[model samples]
Structure formats: structure tokens, C-alpha cells
Target: METKNNKVFLETIHRKLGFCSTTYVDPVGLSGGLALWWKIEVDIDIETSSKNIVHTIISDKSNSSVWAASFIYGSPNREGRDQVWDDLMGIGRTEILPWLCIGNFNEILSSEDKMGGNNPNPARFTSFHGMLSVCGLFDLGFKGPKFTWRNNRRDGDLIMERIDMAFANAKWRELHNQAMVFVDAAIGSDHNPLILNTSFPMQKVGKPFRFESFWTTKESCKSIIEEAWAVEYEGTKMVKVCKKLRGCKEKLKKKLELGFNPDYLVTEKIIKGKLEDLWQKDAMFWHQRSRIKWLQMGDKNSRFFHLSTIQRRQRNQIVKLKDDSDLWKTEANDIAVVYFVGNLVTWRTLAIIGIIPCMVQVVGVFFIPELVKIGKEKDLEATLQRLRGKDADVSQEAAEIRDYFEIVQQLPKARFLDMFQRKYAHSLTVALMVKSSFYKFVTFEVPKTLSFLNCHEHNLNQNKDLTAILVFSGIQLYVATAVGCRVRVTDSHANTLLPLDIKGSAGSLITFCNWASAWVVSYGYIFILDWNPAGTFFILAGICASTVVFVAKLVPETKGRTLEEIQASLTLFT
Candidate 1:
């Protein structure tokens, strides 16, 4: 895609792409270029051209629908990027057709559009937001990878940004309301390909079973349920209940297929009338548009009213939800999907896949040798020698392992009150402060942040955004926990009394905090914060801030200090 001359590859690409007509804005020194290829069925007329954009009016010969599409290669520099927005604003004013603007804008609207590296300049956000506002363009949210552009660095300095995007105005959304933007995997380039589908295809799925209120109106329905429940089943109470409900559903389905008896025809008429009245009311609710007022007074407008009701119902319904792979799953059969071996698989497949690691571990464990500390000194040396290698020296390592094990055995057992002693007070305080704050943030605040993400699902990308948030947050949690583990190990190694017991007590604190956090997050949201996402975050921030201050004031540097020294320091201070 990066080239200065159209002759270099445009003709070949056009032919291979099966596009009848092709046009391009030549690159300015191999850095910026734009190419547009269209099939014969699409009638495209070039309306304007610039170094960064190629504006065209595209008409579908099949439907005779016309729209404007601007292919952009936004300037990478800040000053020129500002000019690109200005040009787009001018085009939005002049162009009357439903407009679509898609390409690499080389800028992002907000911090969420990027990941890693230093935060972007706020002025860039201002320019982008201003352009979108002025042009009345709404971002057509995408699926697939959250970030489209990567720095491609193998080092830790890598950065990713969602610069490539699709945007359409209100008019364009009306014309193709089902339009979707898909970010395809990047091949041989750092930038991912953006696929703008004007109409995303969806599969038709049967509606889920729901018990009708009308069914409850009949005495026969009550008899059918009772009869189904009366069938004896051999299982646990929960299983019996499930079987009964399923039986009831099947019986109701069969009864539904049989036409109403002659005796209930009057009841059917009344139910039908009530349903019609509800539909009529729904129609009245939606018929508030000025042009539909003339037909509002009589049954003459029933057809229009019914169609309006159907449209409103369809618009409000959630027929499908997008899966992790960007596929739409209409059926509710799977309550959850899990990623197995780098691919998203169904719950059934995940159950099967979940056993592989366990089986491998079970088989692999038989081939492994026992611990060196479990035997006498002679046996320990022999075991260590075999584990290391037949030829490797094991005398020094065996002696060290024996001495460490002996020391561990000689240590006194830790008691519940021993942790409260004056010498151990500082250690306990540090553990409580760190563990409480860390676990609270991890178990409680993180879910609250996820709740914030749930609120924005409609406006932003849904499942994929959630996945990205989880991925980064999980990585952060894992790395921080790893560091804490290293510190805890060091602290235990330096302790004189009941090192294992102290470690266990610290672990117990972690477990208790973790258990308490779920209740705190659940009831805390209801009673304390009233489910306010921002308020929950503000409270978490205050907790974290206070913890930071507490750590700075009370926590001592235990680095390179032995247990006796640490105890002496605490005793001197007290």
C-alpha cells in the first residue's frame, strides 16, 4: 500500500481484486498515499482529491443507493493532522449524501483508543473530538483486536494504538444501520486492515421458550403442569426439578400445536382482543411522528400501526450477541465460552479441552523423582546426584539442602498470638497493610472497573474491549503478585522464629481478605455506593491513596536486614 507511483502495483492489484475501476493519490515520497478500488456494480465518481484523502460519491447499481466515501491517509504530523480534520469538516458541510470516512487517521480520540507507551497529548484528543463533533460523525465501533497499529518492537518499549477506524454520520447510519467495522489481522504490516461491511449478515435463529401469560389463564394449563410434575423421576432434588420443568415445557409445546377446542373459542377471542389492544397501544407509543397523525383515529390505520409496532419491537430486541471471534451467536445454549489453546471454543469443547493439561500432568508426574529432603543424608546425596545428572557434582548442593531442612525443622511452631508479639508487630502491620490494600484492589475495585466497562458496551466495542481490559489488568495483577511473592519469600527467609508459620499467617490474611472482598464489593455497591460506578472508583482511590500514605509512614525497609536486626529496630522504636 505504501508507494509513490500508481504504475508500480495498482494495475496488477486492481486486476487481482476484480475491481473494474481504480484510482489513487500518489504517495508524497513513499509516506502517504491513498487507493480506491471498486467493482463494476459500484458506480464511483471522484468528487475531490487531496494529498491525504480521496473523496468519491459511490452509487450501488443494484439498489441505486448513493453515498459518499472518503478514503483517508491522514497526515502523521500534528499540524497537518489538524488540517486533515479541517478538510473533513468542510467536506461534511458540502456533501449531502450519507457519508462514510474510513482509514488510518494517524490520531486517536481518547486514551482508550491506545495502549502502552506514554499517554498521548490531550491536544490531539481535542482536535479529533472537535472534528467528530463538527462533522457529526459517530465512530462505527469495531470488532477483533482492540488496537490496530503496533510499534512492532520486540523490546518492552512497544506501543499499540487504534488509529485505523471507520466513522459515519447519522444519515449514513439510517441507510445502513447494520453496518459493522471489522479489524482484520495485520499481515506484513504494523497496521491492521479495516473492513467496513455496509450490511453485516446475520443468521436466523429460533426464539427461546418462554411461558406465556395466556397459557396460565386456562385450567387445562394447570392440569398439564401438574400431570408433568407427577411423573416419578430418580435423581437429586435439583435434577428432579430440572426434569419436571423440561417435561412441562414439552407438554405445553404439544398442547400449543393442537388447535383450541370449540368450547374455548370465546376465551380465545378475548385473548386475541387483549393482544390486539396491547399492540395498538405499542403502535400509539411509536406513532408520535408528525406525518402519522392523520391516521391515528380509527381501524383504518391498523396495518400501519401494526407495522410500526413490529418495527419498534424488532428495534428493541437483542437477537444476537457477538462472540470473541467477532461471530454473532444467536442461540443461548452456551452460557459462557472459553479460550483454549489460543482459540475461542464452546463450553462443551472447553470441558473436553480442560482435561488435557490434567492428563498430561498425571502421566508426567510418574516419570519425576521424589524430593531430596525426604531421605537420609546418604539417600539425599544419591537422589540429588540422579536428579542433577550422573556426572554432575552434588556434594555442596546436598549439604546446603540438608542444612536448610534441619533449620526449618528446628524452628518453633508459629501461634496465632505470636504474630501479635512486639518483635513481629512491624511484620504483621506491613503484611496487613499490603495484603488488605492489594487484595481489595484486585478482588473488589477491579470488578467495579469492569462494571464501568459494562455500562459503555453500547457506545464502545463490547466483548473484545472487555477481553482487552481483562488481559491488561490480569497481566498487571500477575506481575504485581509475582513481585509480592518474591518479597514474601525474602522476608520469610530472613525471619528467625516460625518462618513457615509467619508465612502461613500472612497467607491466611490474604485468604480472609479475598473472601471478605467479594461481600464488600457486592453489598458495598448496594448499601454504601448504591451501584454508582464512579463513586465506587472514587472510594477505591481513597483506599489506595490512604494505603500509600500508611506504607510510607509505617512500613520499614527490611531489605538486607536479618530477623534479629529487624526485631531490634522495632523494639528500639517501641
Candidate 2:
């Protein structure tokens, strides 16, 4: 029915039922921009039943708000659908106690719900099921209304589908004795309106209880009077009273726990068990199907089998990882898997280039000095002839040889050898040292013969005890240590003193370098110089120059001290 103003219609419903009213508009587009919709929502508190509050909404094409209210645009393919549902459920769970979720979902629950025989996408159906489970919603049984919508085409083919549905939450299920759906007669429209009847009795105003004068005193309390009354009865009355009190206490405790410990109490075990049971049931069905040829012919039942199989596998995985003993272990395993895959990809890329430079660099760094010394003494056949031809400028030749030796010394032997080995021996050694020192700082160990002072301190803190030593031994720590060693080496080469005196900040710097390398590795080609030999030499020279500067300026001095003491002594040197 049309009213003078659209607001008046909601007001009239509120006056008839005596309940609070509110309206919600769903935004247009998946990204959540405001849009026009024709939707009206009404909440009625019927004096008939404490829990029987009617929430109804009606909308049409004139107001696009109805479409938004029903989350028409919030499809799986569209963005922010999950967030919208989460927010909607949060509000519905809090404000509405006994919820009756009825609207045009704009999506079908299953292929059976649609008129056409066209196959439905499994992924979309899975997403719909997930939404239903997340909200803890169940379909209210409707026998009369088979279809709510029909095809608008002029063709002889008449296709009808049930796009509209009614869902109820746990609260509604508790108070509702019975529910049934009635399909109203269609009046030229392509859709049918559904009428729901719930069996709930009307409630009357309750009278306030009056207390006697003696009840005001603390000693003459309600519990004492109830106990006296129970004592007057037989053994059955005492047992019933005790049972009633116990039930009330248990219920109160549960209510308090639900309010205060919601996060910890929301266990998914029941859901997981249900999923597992589905798998076992399906397995039995498959065995039965294998034995009977008629069952094999009817393959439609296999749909449930497939769905349950997938859900069972997923739930099993979640349960395994969520177990108390397996949480951190599973996380560590996942981290290791990622690390292994990344390392494999990196090594594969290097192998494709067929460059043996790392190997050559390793041989040169470790064995070149010995080889050069031996070659000088054993291969001296051309020395006399070269001396005769050039008047034997001994001093100049010696100077040139000395310069070559110095350049060789600055070739970053340990760093180059590590790259060649691909085992990161030197980096791993430093990391172990750092980890050991960190452990020592955090752990308290008693010596075989404790001093008097140590014994006193131990006695003072007797109540508290420490267990489960923190060990950062994994890919995360390994990567951090490698980056730290590289940064230290780079600084040493450039002769620059890094700001290592700041406590705990060195780790932060190393972490930044590790993160930065991920982005830098992608743009390696941008830093490539000319391919000519002279250009290569120039690039090498530049590296040497930078190394010298870093060594002089940034590298911190760590000649004869442990890592733990290094931070404390940093300021003394500077």
C-alpha cells in the first residue's frame, strides 16, 4: 500500500506492533560506494511473546536501497563482500536477539533452486555455503513456495526460480516452537511473497513481588526461607531444589564466560568434527554405490561426496595446525617450505646462465698466493733474457710486483669464497656466535660452585622460574644474520664507522637490509655497466675505492672483543 510519505509506512507498522525501527541501505558497486535502493525495514515487539519480535522489510525497483540492504552487489567475484558480511553479522548478532533473516539474496543456494537445468559453478556454490556457515544461518522449512521468480522473456519457455529465502539464527530456533512457509498468490508479478507463521503465545505484564519486614535483615534471607520450605517437604523436594540451584549456577557461569571470554571460548571443534563425519558417511556411501549398479547410474549423489571430501580435507588440515603442540611447529614448517622453494628458484636461475665465475673466484682467493710464489721460483727460464734486453730495472719491477700483491690482498677472499661455496660457512659461523651470546644474555644458569652473592639472589626470587629457552634458529634468523654480515663487510671495505653504539638497533638495520634486498634483486639489470673489458675494470676499481672508504669510515673496530661487549665498548673507541 502507498502512503503520503515513504517514512509514514514504517511509522504505521511500528504503531501497530510497538517496536523499535531502523533502516539499512546497501551501497552500490563492490567497493562500497553509496547507491540508491528501494528498501524499508521495520522491527515490531508484539506483546504476545517475549522472543517473538517481527522484523520485516519491503522494497521495489523505485528504491534501490533494498538491493543494497540485501547485499546484492556483494558477490564472491566482487571486492569487500567478506567484510560486508562480517559487519552485517556483527550487527545482527548484537542488536537482534531472535533473528529472522528474510530477503532476496540475489544468488541461488544450489542448482536445484533455479528453474533452468543449466549447470552451476561449484566454486560459487562453495562460496555461498561458506557464507551461510559463517553466519550460522539455517533455512526455515518452506513447503508451499517452490519458486519466487520467473523468466521475464516472451518465449514459450517458462522458467521459475526460488531466489528469496528465510533464515533463522540459534536464538530464534530456541524460542520458536514451530515454523511454516505460506506462498501468497501472485498478482501479475514474476515473484511470490512468502508468509511465515510462528507458534508463540502473547505475554502479559508481570506484577512486582512484595517482601516482608523480616526479609530486609541479612540473617533472614531468601535462601534461608527457601531452605526451610524445602526441609518441610519430603526427600524428593530436597533433591529437586538442589538440582535446580545447580542448574541455575551452571547457566550463570556459562553466560559470564560467554560475555568475558568469547574469543577463547569460540571453539571450532564441533564444526571440524561435523566435517570429518561427513567424510566417513560419504565413504560408506561410495562402498554401497560400488556394490550396487543402480546406485552407480544415479551419479547425482556424488555431488555431496565431492563437496564433503574437499571440506573434510580442509578441516583436517586446520585441526592439525590448530592443535596446541603443533601450532608453532606447523608455522616453522611452512616457513621452511617457502625458503626451500625460493632457494631452488634462485639456484636454477644461476645454473641457466652457465657462469663458472664463482668457482674461479674461489680457486683464485684460496690458492693463488701459493701458486704465484711457486711459479716465481720454478718458472725463471726467461728472467736472464728479459734482464739483458731491458738493462734490468730491478727497483721498478719490484715496485710493480708489490702493487699487484697489494691489490690481490684486497680482493675480499672470505666473502668471495663464501659466494662460491654457496654454503655460507663464514656467515653461518658469525650467526651462531651472535645467537649463543644472545642466549647467554637471556638465560640464567647456575655454576657448579655459586658465589655467596649469587646464592642470595637465587634465594630471593624463588617463586618465579624460567623454562623453554628462546631459540631463534630458522630461515628468518639465518637471513637476518647473512644480511648483517654483508652490511658489516661492506662498511669495513668502505672504511666508515656505522652507528653500532645504539642498543638493539643493529638488528633493526640488518632487518631493513634483508627486506631491501628483495626489492633490489628485481632491478639488478638497472645497475649493470658497459660490457667492455675496460668498463669492467673501471667498475672493479670503483668497488675497490668504495671498499677503502667504507673500511676507513663506516666499519666498527672489533679486534679483540666478544659481540656482547662490543656495544658497551663502542663509545670508548669513538
Candidate with maximal TM-score: 1
Per-candidate clashes, comma-separated: 0, 28
Estimate every model's Cα lDDT from 0 to 1: 0.65, 0.41
Q: Candidate 2's residue-wise lDDT over 359-451, tens digit each?
A: 433333334333343555222323422534665554554444445545555554333223323233233223223322221111211110122
Q: What is the lDDT of candidate 2?
A: 0.41
lDDT score, candidate 1: 0.65
- Tens-place lDDT per residue, model 1, 160-205, is 9999988888778777766667777798889999987777654346
Misplaced by over 4 Å in model 1 are 1-5, 203-574
| Cα error, candidate 1, residue 242 (Å) | 19
Name model 2 segments beyond 4 Å from true.
1-84, 89-96, 156-158, 200-574
Candidate 2 lowest-lDDT run of ten: 440-449
State each model's C-alpha RMSD to the native.
21.7, 30.8
